[model samples]
Target: MATSNGGLRNMTEGSPARHIVLFALPLLAGSFLQQLYNMVDSWVVGQYVGDAALAAVGIGFPVIFMFTSLFMGLANGGTVVIAQFYGAGELDRVRDAVDTIYTAFTFSAVPVTLLAVGLVKPILFLLRVDDAAYDDAWLYLTVVCAGLIGTIGYNLNAGILGGLGNSSTTLRFLAVAALLNIALDLILVLVCGWGVFGVAIATVVSQAFSWLYGLWYINRRYPQIAIRPFCRRFDRSLFGQIMGIGLPAGIQMSLVALGAMVVMSKINTFGKEFTAGYNVGYRLDQLAFLPVQSLSNAVTAFVGQNIGARRLDRARQGIRVTVVSSVVWSLLMAALLIPFGPNLVGLFSDTPAVIDAGAVYLRCIMPFYAIFAVMFSLNNAMRGAGESMFPMLDAIFSLILLRVPAVYFLANRFGSDYMYYGIGIGWMLGFTLSALYYLSGRWKRHGSLADRDRRA
Candidate 1:
C-alpha cells in the first residue's frame, strides 16, 4: 500500500524510525544550507558593512516574521491537510488542497507586502531600533517586504511537497537558492558596494528564483498536482478547512513573533553590540537545533499520514522515536556549543565584547535545548493530528504570557546575562503542558480528513 514514485514516499507502511530518519535527513541538510545563507548575510554585513548593519538585519527579522507568520501557519495547515488526504489515497483532494494553498497565497501576497512595507518604520521606531541602525533596518525590511511574494511562494511550494512526503525535492531547491544567495550576497555587498540594500536584494532575487524553479519542477515532475498560476482555481470548502486549522496556528506564530520583538526591544536598550551579539548567538542557536526542528517536522508529517491511514499505533511510535532522537541530538549540540560558543561567535565579529555577549546567551540557553525539543515535538504532533488549537493556546501561554514577561523581569532585575533564562523557563512550561496533553491521547479524537470522509 506504500507508494514511492515521482518523488513521493508513503510513510504509513514503513518502519517508523526508518521513515522518520530518512525523511528528516534531507530536511536537516536543507535547513542547514538555508541557515548557512542567512549566516552568510550576517557575516557579510558584520565584517564588511559594520555592527550597525548587523544589528539592523537582526532588528528586521522578528518584524518581518511577525507579518509573514500567518501565511506560514496557513501553509503548515495545508501541508497537514494534503498529507492526510494523500495518506488516505485521496489524490483528488490532495491536488485540490495544493491548488487552494497556491491560490490563497498568490492573491494575498501583495496586500500583505504593502501593509508590512508601510508599517516597517513605525514598528522599527516602536522597537527602539538604535539611530545608527534604523535607516538600514528600514530599507532592508522594506525591500524584503516588497518581494514578499517570492518568500511566500517558496514556503508554500515547500509545504506542498512536504505534504506529499517529498522533502528531498525541496532540499534540492534550497541548495540552489542557498548557493545563489551566497553568491549574490558576495557580489552585491562586496563587489557592488550596495551594503545592506545589496544584502536584501540578494535575498529577494534568490528566493524568487527558487520559487519559480520549484513551480516549474513541480509542474514537470508531478503533474498530479500541477500549479496553474493563471487558472486561479479556488476551492471555497478546502480554503475554509485550511483556515480552520491554520488560523489558530497563525495567531500563535504571530504572538510568538510579537513576543520576540518585545524581547528584542529590551535587548536594544543595551546597545548595538549586544543586539549584534544576540543576533549571532540566536543564529548559532538556530543552527544547533536544526536537527531537532527537522525531526519535529518529520514527526508532524509522519503523524499526519499515519493518522489518516487510521494507524494510531504507528503515529504514536513515530513520535516516540523522533522525541528520543531529538533529545539525544540536543544533548550533543549542547555539549559542543557550551565550550566553544565564544569561538564560534568570533566568526562573525572580532570584537571581544560582541563575542563575550554572544557566549553568555549560548551558555544560558544551550543546556535547556532538550526541553525545547520535547515541547516542539509533542506540540507539533498535536498539530499533525489536526489538534492545532490547543497547541496555539499552549504557545500563547508559555511563549507570550510567560516568556515575554519573564524576559522583561529578569533583564530588569538580574541584568542582561540572566535575560535568556526566561527562554528556558518558557521551554519548561511548554514541555510540561505538551507532555500532559500527549499522554492523555485525546489528540486522536481531533479527526483527520479521512475520518470526516468516513463519517459523511
Candidate 2:
C-alpha cells in the first residue's frame, strides 16, 4: 500500500522480480473467477438440461468468443497505450487514454450486441445445430448477447486497471461477477426450471454486477480516468492509432474463432454425443488455461509499464521468468486433469455415453496444456512490448490455414476424436513461431512504442 524507493505502483516503472509476481497474484485469482463465471453456466445447464442442450450451448461458444474479441482487442490496445502514458509521466494523456477506452467500449458494443441479437437464429443454423439443439441454442445465445453492455464495461475497466498495473482491481470485479453468476445459476436452473435459458440469464445478470462494480471503482478511486459520456467527441488521429493497434489483434482472434467454429462444426457431424464431449472438455480446460493465461496478462502489463520506462532488459527478463513459471504451473495442472478427467467431465453429464465421450476429450487435450502456457506467456509478452504482428499472423496461419483444414481431411482416419489433435497441432505451431519471433530478437529491431514516449 505504501510506496518506498521501490514499490508496487499501479504503473510499475521498474522491473523488480518479486514485485511483478506480487502485482500478478490478485489477477490470477480474478482470472480464475472469470473462468468460473463462464463455467458456472455450463455446470448448471449440464446438471439440468441434459447433454443435447449442453452441446447446443457448446456450439455457441466460438460465436460468443468472436463477438467479444473486438471488445478485447480495443481493451488490449488501450491498456498498452495508457500504460505507456503512465510510464512517460504523462498523466493527462493517461487519463485521456482511459476516456478513449470507455468511449470505444460503448460504440463497439452497440453494433456487436445488435448483430448478435439479430443473427441468433441464422448463426445457430450455420453452426449446423440439429433439431434437438435448435430451441436451446437460440435461447442461450440471445440472452448472452443481450448482456454485451455489461461485458463491455467489465472489459474496459479491467483493461484500464491492467494498463495501470493493478490487476487486483480488475479481479475484484470478476469475483463479484462470478459469485453473482453462481447464485443465479442455481436459482434459475434448479429452482425455476429455466434450463438453458437459465444459464444465459444467470451469466448476463452476473455480468451486470461486474460491470457496475467496475464503473463504480474507477469513478470513485481514479476520477481522473472517468469520461463524461457523450460530452467528449472522438479524435480521428487517436481513433486511428487505437484501431491500428487493435485491428490486427481482432483479426487474429477472429481467425482463431473461425477455426474453432469449424472444429465445432466437425464435432456436430459426429452428432450431439461427441459435440457434448467437446463442450465439456472445452469448458473444463478453461480452469487450467486461466492460470497461465492470467500470468501472461500480468507479464504484458509488467513488460508494457517497464518498457515505457526504457527498461528493455528488465522486460525481457520478466518474460523469461514468466515463461518458466507457467510451464511448471501448467504441468501440475495437466497431471491433475489427466488422471481425474472422468470425474471432472462427468459433472456435466448424467448419461454414461456422454460422460465417456467427455472424459476422452479431456484426457487427450490435457496433455498439451504446457504448450498453451508457453504460447500465451510468450505471445502476450510480445504484444505487451508492442510486437503483436508476429503472434497475430501465427495464429491465423496455425489455427485457420493449418488446423481447420486438417480437421476436415483427417476427420475420417482419426475418427471424431481428431478435433483434439487439430487444435493441439495448431497450438504447437503457433507456440513455436511465437517463441522463435521472440528469440530472434526481432521485437527489438522493430522499434517500439516506448521509443515514441522517449521522444515526447
Candidate 3:
C-alpha cells in the first residue's frame, strides 16, 4: 500500500482534528469555487442579461437538482464504502467498489440525460415558471439537463477520491474548472451575448473537463482503484454493498430535492421579484454554508476510514471535533452576513427591490446557520459509519413533514418574509433528530462482517 503522489491521504492515523482540518480546507475551497460558478452566473446575468434572466436560471436549478440527486446520493454512498475499505487496507475491495459505481452511473446517466431533456417543458410548467422568464428557464434547463453525464462523471470520480481520503485531488480538479467557468461565463455571456445559454454551456464544459481530469489522474496515479471496464463476472456482491448504502443516501437527497421543488413552486407563485431575490439569497446561503458542508464531507471520509481500521473511538472523536469547528465557522459567517447582507445582495443585481428582498431573507436566515451545521456534522458522520437510514429519515421528517408545509402556509398566509422562518424551524428539528440518533450510538453496532472480511 504505497501512496501515489500526495493524492492519497490515510486519515486513520495521527490527530483527528489536524487531519480533518487539513482534509476539509481543500474541500472548503473547492466547494466555494464550485458555488462561485453559480454566483458568477447570477452576477453576469443580472448585470448584463437582466433580472428576469437571473430569475429564469434560478428557476431551472431545482429541475436540474432533481435529476442529479440520485447520482449524488449513490456517489456519497460509494465514497463511504470506499473510505472504509481504504481504511481497512483492502485495496482489492476498493477497486471493486470504484468500478461498480462507475458501471452503475454509466448505465444510469444516459436515461437520466434523455429523460431530463425531454421533461424540461413539463417540469418548468409544474414549477409555475412565469411567462416573463419562461423562455430563459426552458433554454437553461434544456442545455444543462442535456449535459447530465458530465455531472455524473465528475462526481463519480470525485466521490471515489474523497472516500480514499484525497480531498486535494478533488480540489485541484475543481479549482481548474472553477477558473475556467468564470472566464467562460464572462466571455460567453457578457461579450458574446450568449445569455442563459452561454452560462449553461460554460458549466457543462467546465464539468466535463473536471471529469476527464479526474478519470485520467485516477488511472495514471492510483491504477489499483482506477475504474476499468465491466467484465462478465462483475462483482455483484460489491455492487450491493455500495448501492445498499448509496440508495438511501440518494433517496434522501431526491426527497430533499423534491421538497425544494415544492418550495420553489410556492416561491414562483409570488412572481419574479421574489424568485430573483430568493435565488440570489440561496446562492449566498450556499457560499456561507460551505465550511460546514466541507467539514461534514471530510468527517464522512474520516469516520469511514477509522471505522474501517477498527478505530470506532477515533471516528467518534473526529465527529465531535468537526461539530465544534463547524459551529464556530457557522457563527462567524452568520455574524459577518447578518448586518451587511444588503451589500452582499447588491452585488448580484442593482435593483433596489431585489436587494431589499434578498437582504431580508439573509438577515432572517443567517442566525440559524449553526443549527443546520450541527445537523449536517452529526448526520454525515452517521453516513460515514454506514448508517444512512436515520439521516434520510430525519431529512424526510424535517423537510417534507415540517418545512414544506410551513413554507407554503407562511408564503400564502403571512408573506415571503415569514417563509424564511421555516428554515430555522426545519434546522432545529433535523438537528434534534440527528443528535438523538448519534447519542443513541446505533451507528456503532451497524458494522458489517463484509467490512471485516475485506480486511481479512
TM-score, one value per model: 0.98, 0.93, 0.96
Candidate 1 lDDT over 134-199, as tens digits, reads 899999999998887877888888888888888999998899899999999999999999999999
Q: Candidate 2, TM-score vs. the true structure?
A: 0.93
**lDDT ranking, best first:** 1, 3, 2
| Candidate 2 wrong stretches, greater than 4 Å | 1-15, 446-456
Instruction: Pick the lDDT winner.
Output: 1
What TM-score quantifies how close candidate 3 is to the native fold?
0.96
Query: For model 2, what is the error of residue 77's alpha carbon versus the real structure, in angstroms, after optimal superposition?
Result: 0.5
Separate clash counts for every candidate: 0, 1, 0
CA lDDT of each prediction against the hidden true structure:
0.90, 0.75, 0.86
Task: Enumerate residue pairs that collide in model 1.
Answer: none
For candidate 3, list the clashing residue pairs, or say none. none
